[model samples]
Target: MRHILHNVYSYLTRCVFIFIGDITLNENRMLIGYARVSTDEQTLDVQLDYLLKAGCSLVFREKVSGAERDRPELNKLLKKVRRGDVVIVHRLDRLARSTKHLLEITEYLQHKKAGFRSLSEPWADTTSPAGRMILTVFAGIAEFERAQIRERTAAGREHARARGVHMGRPAKLMPSEAVLACRMVTDDGMPVAEVAARFGIHKATLYRILTRRQAMKSTDKSLNKIEKISQTYKCQLYE
Candidate 1:
């Protein structure tokens, strides 16, 4: 019921725009075209011919899949668009990989005060107020879904942490193995490289583990000496 209300509101808003005559469809606006093919085996002749006949002043062409995010020609056309310019494509699929992607592109064009149009899918055209209203509602819904996903992911991570689950990669060496490696290097006076190779670990890693163990031992000894001094001072005070 709420979805129906949103659609009705969007339709009403589009009507208001049309009634106000705030946006004109074909008044000194440049039509920029973009043509794309998934592979070299697929010829772009049909798309190019259609774009040229659509009165596009300039057309950017490339042979790249819509799924690929780094399309050079599409990037160029997007950068070329200015305020009041309409970007024309041979088909909807030629412009974006999915509905989310289409909404994102149209949102960007709208931000630039430009417009988007599809030769095959007339309803997808953003040059008209109705098309803009429809796409805006879709973009809003997509954003809401994405926010829900992010919230769920963060809650899941927090739950895992509360249950004492490790989040990242497991440690390479066990506690006993690390203790033995450090002893071999320090007590037995063995070469660090030889000890590391025998344990099938990197020399640098072995050094880090040994250094940490040594620092821990040093701290323990210091704490023991401090306790002894405190005990002796108490004896003197009691005497």
Candidate 2:
């Protein structure tokens, strides 16, 4: 009876230890932070400070344009985030410039079962129910605004086109310059490389112009030969 009691006590102690270990594992908070600066004039330090003060375990930052998609630090931060982790940002706009991009990032986090928190905006935390609703509304408004802007731009372009205004990059070489380069290569027997260097144009451009000229000449010659053959055929038939 004494040995049996001792064995039972040992088993109970082991069970308690396992239970404590599980609780400790569940209590670990995984928090990550991300910050961005649009230009050299902007500083990421202020954003990073707020994230640290808010209890972020790790932080990532980048000095890149908000319009750019391929941000190295942002990618690293996303990869490091695990399920049940929290991603903190100073503001939503700092994370992404466009509403579509913002929604995409947020949705990805949600899919990963991670939460999002904005230090400045209390209504921007995904960990709460109200915050999720607020973010959905905000995302809808942003997408609407972007669509309106795009429509206005398209209308403006159409109006300008109606007024006979040209759009897009201006021609790099004038028609006269292109014609002159073609003549130099075809009639003057100037080497394409020399012509390109002399005219301050790229060798590729020179080659393109020369090739176009050659194609035109070939087409003209083909038409002339066809006309001659037709005339001879007509004469022979009449004779």
lDDT of each: 0.65, 0.62
Best by lDDT: 1
**Which candidate should be chosen as best, given TM-score against the real structure?**
1
Candidate 1 residue-wise lDDT, 1-239, digit = tens: 45545655664464344322333445788999999888755688899899999999989987876556567777667657776888999998888777756765665565456778899988777767677666656655665564555467668889999999887732456553564455444434556665564455556666566556555776654234323333443333323
Worst 10 residues of 1 by lDDT: 222-231
lDDT of 2 by residue, 22-66 (tens): 211135668888988888555777997898898888888878876
Query: Candidate 1 regions off by >4 Å?
Result: 1-27, 165-239
- Report the backbone clash tally of model 1: 0
Worst 10 residues of 2 by lDDT: 16-25
The collision pairs in model 2 are none
lDDT of 1 at 24: 40
Error of 2 at 97 (Å): 1.4
Quote model 2's TM-score: 0.47
